[model samples]
Target: NAGVTQTPKFRILKIGQSMTLQCTQDMNHNYMYWYRQDPGMGLKLIYYSVGAGITDKGEVPNGYNVSRSTTEDFPLRLELAAPSQTSVYFCASSYHGGGYNEQFFGPGTRLTVL
Candidate 1:
């Protein structure tokens, strides 16, 4: 089953630029999240959406934003990117909600800022 998929497996950007981390799921799941994974570190949740029309910020939401208008698409937007945002971003989804622990993650989108 196709769980989650992210685009631009690798990328390089300049300072003050922006990009969107695309996230899509074919399972028709209801929960989705966008997280940034730094070198040798656990994934840090940036933003998440419980369902369409419902979104919220996570642990680290600074410089990032998101909108959930559909169950299958939850994209992460970075406005005014910085070097600090040059990390591997991952998109994930789950079939359940309310603190569900089983989350399926995409390969990742590695971004590098120069």
Candidate 2:
């Protein structure tokens, strides 16, 4: 299986612009998440879903949104992007949810908002 895949591996946006970072997994994993890492900082969760029809905001969910309509896709949307939103975005997945959160990650999408 391809595990997880994210498209447009890189992106640059003007402040106030918007974009969607696509994420998909083939592991049939039930848990999906979106996280951002700013330079040397640890990964900050943006949003996550325990399963289809279930979603929750994470630690740093500002300016971001996510949805889990299926077991395979969990895309992230950025609205009115700002320079402060510039970071490396990672999409991850794991088996089950509301428990241990060990996740399998994607190669990541680097987004630069100027």
Candidate 3:
């Protein structure tokens, strides 16, 4: 099973454009998360979902949105993309929401908004 998968390994979007980053997990994880990593910086959570039908914004949710309709998929939407949103985005999933479980990370999507 593909633990986690993300589409478009790399992208370059013009400012004001919009895009959706797709994420899917075959492990049936209960918790899924979206995070962004900037150059020389640690990752910052953008959104998370504990389960299907339940989603929440994370530390950096501005200009971003997420939806979780099934245990296997969580997609992130970027609206009016800006240069500030340029970063490497990663999608991760875990069986537990806390530290008890290990999170499996997908090969990140590198996005650059010019």
Candidate 4:
């Protein structure tokens, strides 16, 4: 209620299946991001938005889709889920000023594709 929240704390998918990772923030942040972290690797940005109805692709946007319809919601869509897509997905939000902004992350969704 105070920060970012992601749904389905855990999930498993078969090859070619699809699912949407839900994210929402109550902090009214203007910037939101979606990232995926593989085991023992750094977090790679998938997509981001500066504000509602505005979004942009990040380092790894393939096999993923996103939309920002409201300031509070930003969901990540996985189409034709693949084994390479199996990783921990995270959602973060932050204000884009003050020199260095801090990101608030959700608990994350652990996804597995088999």
Off by over 4 Å in 1: 98-101
Candidate ordering by TM-score (highest first) = 3, 4, 2, 1
> 1 or 2, which is superior by TM-score?
2
Q: Which one wins by lDDT: 1 or 3?
A: 3
Q: What is the lDDT of residue 103 in candidate 2?
A: 88
- Per-residue lDDT for 1-114 in model 3, tens only? 878999989999999999999999999899999999998999999999999999998999999999888899999999999999999999999999988899999999999999
**Worst 10-residue lDDT window, candidate 2:** 95-104
Q: Estimate candidate 4's RMSD in Å.
A: 1.3
TM-score of 3: 0.98
Q: Give Cα distance to truth, residue 53, candidate 4, Å.
A: 0.4
Query: Each model's number of backbone clashes?
Result: 0, 0, 0, 0
The better-scoring model by TM-score among 2 and 4 is 4
Quantify how close model 3 is to the true structure by its C-alpha RMSD in Å: 0.6
- lDDT winner, 1 or 2: 2
Model 4 lDDT tens row, 1-114: 669999989999999999999999999999999999998999999999999999999999999999999999999999999999999999999988334989999999999999
Of candidates 4 and 3, the better by TM-score: 3
